[model samples]
Target: MGLVRNRVGLPAKCDLQIKAKREVCSFEFHSVPGDKSISQRAIVLNAIAEGQGTVYNVLRSRDIESCITILRQLGVRIAWNGDELSVHGQGLRGLQAPAGRLEVGNTATSARLMLSVLAGQSFAAELGGNALLSARPMDWVVQPLTDMGAVIEYLGAKGCLPLRIQGASPLSPIDMEATVFSAQEKSALLFAGLYAEGITRYRQRCQSRDHTERLMHYFGIDIHSDNDVTFLKGGNAFCAKDVMVPGDMSSAAFLLAAYAIRGVDRKGSLLIKQVGVNPTRSGFIRLLAEMGLHLTLQAEAELISGEPVADIYCTPGTRLSSVLAEGNGRIQSLIDEVPLLAAVSAFAEGNTVIRDCGELRDKDTNRIQTTAGVLKAFGVETSCSDDEMVIHGGRPLSPAIVNSCGDHRIAMTAAVLASSLDEPSIIRNCGCINVSYPGFVEDLSQFAHIDVLPAE
Candidate 1:
């Protein structure tokens, strides 16, 4: 099957209407989509396992769909029933050489992780992506895999996408320290190490996301992590098991920010059900709670597929205080949610500063530049250096036109900022929101005065 465009786009025709701010007390509850991080990892692990397995509640967004399409092209059989996904594996060595190029449209996770999986196979294949995906840095993954005996050549840009990879059998294991803090890079090494001849050890300067490691342990792989170091044994086999992906915490952050700012005036409480509150991915929740928002964990946490899942309960709060986002370790946890948090900071009681976030420059767009521009469009005073953003909160915001920069998180963040405005505003390139949350506009409309209009 060919990759599908989820929505059409118009340059200036589409306009978002943001009604005047009012007390929104109507009762609101929503079940967001499955975690994209977990869904992507589960699909990869299941495809490489020794037996068939079912993954329940998988996210059905562009990113997850890209994983499905790429896996199918590599000769893996995957069946989809509603939100349940069944994968029939051909073991670690079972993937056949694709008849043609594997297209991963705009999904960095799929491109990076799958490159590692293909490194150990005894064939040659080319991986290509759309314009946005082609610009993202692949050297972080390529250099490591190349060091371990994989032959990877750049078909286009030296360090970018359109790669030609020749599989390396009996891969060599190496002891390396990650110069940059990236879970994708670390995961790529670990995945390739699964097929190596010996143990592979990796130490990170700061802790990155642990979804890959957790999923590995869930599948019975011999993996362990202590401090900032991780050890994985090669020549191991994977046994598939049933996995239930919880609601994405990143997608849930927009709702939490909405209620945290507007819920106090509403008559009912706001509850988001069964979200994956993995510590590595829960920085936004913790930061908001620390900012004096009445957020709480309502149920005991459950461990599913090595991830922590729980129900999140939030009641309206009177005000929000500023919090600092610095340090290498803490920034990696909330990296994706910084734009949302920056938008929310416009109405806080004090100035909010986010530092050690230069990595934002390397996303689908320059998030640091786009986020500051969006805040400025809404009449919020913001300033940014190379790796830091400072928002002077407690300022009045005005209705204005903003741009999404074709980034999904930027589009969602703009929508949230528009909700609290005194009048309506427009957000350009809003259709790109489907990359992560296809139901974002529909779900938020149930609780806020927001409307999605097609380009005229």
Candidate 2:
């Protein structure tokens, strides 16, 4: 077997064993786990709401656990009974200060967005994270927050983690534009706007996720989007509302690629139920359709907690053709799913070009280069650049020895590619998958046999 080494200095955890048949049997179920993005938002928004809030289908993952843990430390009452989540609101100005530094684990989403909320509280608090989270840049979210009167003191590196923040009540609301296409940055601004007295306006570099915007509106916050611009009216107390989080689109994308590529020559279709179909997060769906995947979404989509929910049905075996997946316009939506696309595209009849992927550098690893390395390890020829990757497809694949490098998506993507062959693929450091989709191995088991081996 060919080897692709782990380069990010990740300690050995466990090996993921997945060997999928060349063809998959059709299956359908009611659940696919909750959306991580929506789950984190629901936990925070409802925690600071005016009354008690009930959240249905919140994903129990490491990333989301960070949000819940921090909220509890801030004196918010949250209870989850395995099915439903209940959060007692602290109102708009009620969160108590933690005893010391609030240590948020490896979740960057939890750290950045939570900092924005912390900026509106009435205490000076310090936020810290694990080594991985500490290395990421927080400037995009911090700068906007500072402009709104939040005093930020970096205890470590500038714009990185482990910092103290002092929030301003009646923070000055301002119209601002983002230099990066980031949903988190937009959400950081809007969430802090609740403490401001006037309207806070935000502009994006490109269209990104809008779960924050939609959830704000759901909880009776005055927020609206005109074209790509969003505005939030401040000083409004939130009314506790029930939120039903849809299944994660990011997780669903992995399932879709695995079954779709293998299903092409099989009978029957796989039905993925009640997954998010937000247009802002549907770039991969559009791209796959353009690549000739046989897919159908329910015509009558349901709206849950301000997000579109639909049952997506797919039958594999359609010949895939490569289409340009450019970054500027579609990167925000596809950033989390590009690895899956690039890996599955190895079966496509032509060369697949993914351009302007520089944003991937800021992920847990340099995913752009890491993805190229994984593909090459599987005997797929690839041309990689700083901002672009071209995968030469339509060739036979060999068994591969790959590493996740602590990236969940990269591991899952490589496993999906391995499932296409008769031999199993060994993925090191798969514990990282718990950060996002804890149920992924079970879900993928529908198409293959998975073995969780002890780390040496």
- How would you encode candidate 2's per-residue C-alpha lDDT over 316-395 as one tens digit per residue? 64688887889676877887888888997898889999987787888888899889889999999998888888999888
Please, what is the TM-score per model?
Answer: 0.95, 0.94
Name the lDDT value of residue 168 in candidate 1: 89
What candidate 1 gets wrong by more than 4 Å, as runs, is: 1-15, 20-23
lDDT of 1 by residue, 370-395 (tens): 99999999889999988999999987
Taken over the whole model, the C-alpha lDDT of each candidate is 0.83, 0.82
Candidate 1 root-mean-square deviation in Å:
3.9
Q: Which stretches of candidate 2 lie over 4 Å from their true place?
A: 1-12, 22-24
Q: Could you tell me how far off, in angstroms, the CA of residue 322 lies in candidate 1 after the best superposition? A: 1.3
**Which is the leading candidate under lDDT?**
1
